[model samples]
Target: MSLAGKVAIVTGSGRGLGLAYAQELAAQGASVIVNDVDAATAAEAVAAIEAAGGTASAVVAPVGPSATAKALVDAAFERYGRLDILVTNAGVLRDTVLWKMSDDDFDTVVDVHLRGTFTCVREAASRMREQGEGGRIICIGSPTGQRGNFGQTNYAAAKAGIVGMVRTWAMELKKAGITANAVIPVAATAMTATVPYFHAAVEAEAKGEAMPAFFRHDLGFGDAGDVAPLIAHLASDAAAGVTGQAIGVGGDRLQLWSHPEPVATAYREGGWDAAALSEEFDAIVGERLQSVGEKFPPLPEELQPPQA
Candidate 1:
């Protein structure tokens, strides 16, 4: 995936997964723009890349804000004179159940994850369209967004919203040769470590304590570097035709999932009366609700602890 002469912008590249993506892309010959909320860390990452014989520049801006996102894109164009790839990886985790979750918490998560992604993609898509050459937009997503998790209503909602954005953007930009997609990654990072339940599960396993069956299986706890390869590929010219898809990258596994399932159901040729409509709607809703419990069975005793 040599990106020689190409310019790439990676948000939250100060450390962890974003840093890994920046380094890998730079190594493949892309002039990388490292964007991060922390000026110091951003500078350090850029300096490190330069020291390693890679081309990079640091752009310090909080990506959650629209103005800042525009600034980050402008900084990339100012430095490199072109924008080829935009990776919206900057995000924060505010874990809380729906009942306990605060408005601020919900807003913050949506602002950073969903709104931030939208701002960057909006700006980048405009530039890419103007450039008249194809471009790539990659949004970082999570499994919790696909399969709901306890105590992460806000996070899950934001992530799920990202997938919707990807699909819509992909369709909207297809004619312009711009591709929009998402990468759902399961890696060990500061955000995951901050969740008490996740931290305790890892610790318990390390100490040889009794653990859940799910924990016993390899849960794809790889280093941040593990996630960079897939992102690099998606951002490359080789994947130009792939868009509007959600791909999962965890450890050595890379898989794609269908967003919605189709099923056979009753239909009415003509408009039905209120009473008939009600009966049909109830049956459809009931069938769907019952399938949920059947598909996702109850957790085992060890894994059924109270969520944080």
Candidate 2:
């Protein structure tokens, strides 16, 4: 997936998945603008790309539906004189059950993930229109939004909202040659380390200690580099026609998710009264409903503590 002569802006690219995306794109010949809230990380990412014989610059700004979002797009133009790809990858995790989640937590997640995506897209789309060249717009999403996850109400809702926005952008920008798509990634990064067990394992590995049993199976899929190929492909001319869809990516797996639609319905001649619904509810809708959440499998007994 050669991106020769192209320029890209990848938000939150100072580290982890975002860094992988930026580096891969640059490695394929695209000049990159690395965006991150942390100045040091952003600079380090840029240095890494330069060391790999690629062109890059860093932007340290607060991520949100604010000037910072537009600044990312502007920085891309400043560095390369054109912007051809925009990846809204900046985000933060605020995990907790809905009942225990605070209003601030929910708002903070939405502000960074959803609103940030919108503002960045808004600026990039406008510039792409002015340049009269279609561009690639990729939004980073999460599976939590597709199949509900425990303790991720805010993050899930924000990711789901990103898909909706990208769908609309795809339709509206098709004639202009723009493609908008979402990637639901599963990679181990600082964000996922918020889970204590995952963090402990990362620390142990850093010190060359024996790892937990699950580290070779479920946890082995933590490499952020595994996600770069799909991102690079999507940002290339090869995927010009693939838009308005959510694609799942992790390890060696790639999945295309179905868009929402009416799977089953019942029509009542008089628009069903409460009594009629009481009689037909199960037959009409309840019976067709699928499972709505995800669950983690239990660890093997040997991986657990000794019996009390």
Candidate 3:
């Protein structure tokens, strides 16, 4: 789908998955506004796009505060005169078990990922609504958020909240014909390179070797570029009918995730109390109880990182 004449803002586009999304949107003929906290990397990203004959401008600032969000939107309008698509991809990881996680760790992750998305979407939505031509809002989520990840309490909460917000926005903005969706992506990037599970793949990539097929197909882990196409698709006109969805992509896999829905429901004549729940709760919803957390297959011997 050609995004020709479209204007997009991709946060944290200085590197990693954000950079990939920005590049792909630009390649598809959109004028991209690249946002990042690091000026040097932001400049590099803009230069890379220009070098590839794509239009891009950089807005160097951290996302979260309304000011920064507004700055990104302003930059887009100032450079491209209008906004059409927004990818809320800027994020940071503060992984820690709940008890060990500090308030700062929790707030930092929530602020950047959850609040940042909210602020940015709020600003972009205002402009799109005023423009009266509809728009696209693509939020970034994670497997940790979809299920639960050990030692990633904060990140999970933020990502899950983002999906929730997207659902709400879809309903609220439907009248304006705007689409809001969340994309859950898994890939090897700066974030995953240090994890033991991806060391072998990361090493192969660093050495200019292809990643093992098993990792890409089975584990749904691949380079950041592997996830970019989905973002572009969601930002295109073809996806106008697709909104309020939590879609997953990575490697060779593309998945449609189900929204939260009750699998079982029980009612009482006079509202069952907790004591009643003790007696009949399991029988009512026990079998329907869903599992939590991501499940991974055992790593093959050859894929294991070499023992240090």
Candidate 4:
């Protein structure tokens, strides 16, 4: 996991998981650019990395839109001379049920998570293509989007969209020797603290108790640091062969999610009418649609955030 001579940019690196990622990459011999909307925290983060014998600079800008995206890449080039590993970890959360969710909430989350990710990816890809040394693109994803979560219609849509971007970019960028992947982390961080179960776990930790199993994931046992090493592994040359994957990392656990694909299909001499389609729908696909959570054993209910 030695990223010697590599230049990396980690958005939202002022604190939490992003801060952990920046420090680890720097420790592994990469020059890092710590990006965050907060000037103080971003500067503080850079200072910490530099104090630890690593090279880093702070860029205070909200992630999203082409201009801010360009600024991030520009900072990397100006300070480090090149960019190699880009971790799109900048985001904001606006959680609410669809009916109660405000337009501002929906727009802001999508702006930060979906559009912001694309803007950064677009700029990074353009430069990586010209640099010709190949690079790594690691995007942040969430289980909420993978399995769906209540009161997260907007967040879920954004995260699911991220996986799609990672897959598409992996295919398109591999020709340039670049790899794209998404990492889903189950760790205790400010963003997740908004969710009840994770917040409860955070509280328990404050009391000097172990995180409860109901809200646990392998390798991600309520520690933001748990997510850092995996990011390092993905960004390093050793993981060049791994691409277009959706991987989960947390408290002593690492797992790959199955890509969605057709499990069943049906055909007829001609397209079936509504009447025929209704009669045959269950016969054709009901088995594939059977509930796995209840029948095959669902994940522990604690994985879900407690109802508001």
Q: Best-fitting candidate, measured by lDDT?
A: 3
lDDT of 1: 0.83
- For model 1, residues 1-308, the per-residue Cα lDDT tens digits are 67888899998899989999999889888999999888899999999899999999988888788897788889888989999999999988887778999999999988999999999899989989999998999999988788877788888888999999999999999999999999988766666666454554555545756444453345544556668998889888899989999998765567796786655367777867888878788776665652211133444566554664
Q: What is the lDDT of candidate 3?
A: 0.93
lDDT of 3 at 91: 95
> Where does model 3 exceed 4 Å of error?
none
**Number of the top-ranking candidate, with TM-score as the measure:** 3
For model 2, residues 188-249, the per-residue Cα lDDT tens digits are 67765555445545565467665564744454444577689899999999998899999987
User: Whose lDDT is higher: candidate 2's or candidate 4's?
Assistant: 4
Off by over 4 Å in 2: 194-220, 296-308
Task: Provide the lDDT at 40 for model 2.
Answer: 89
TM-score for each predicted model, relative to the true structure: 0.83, 0.89, 0.97, 0.89
Superior by TM-score: candidate 1 or candidate 2: 2
* Tens-digit lDDT track of model 4 for 136-190: 9999998877888778888899999999999999999999999999999877876
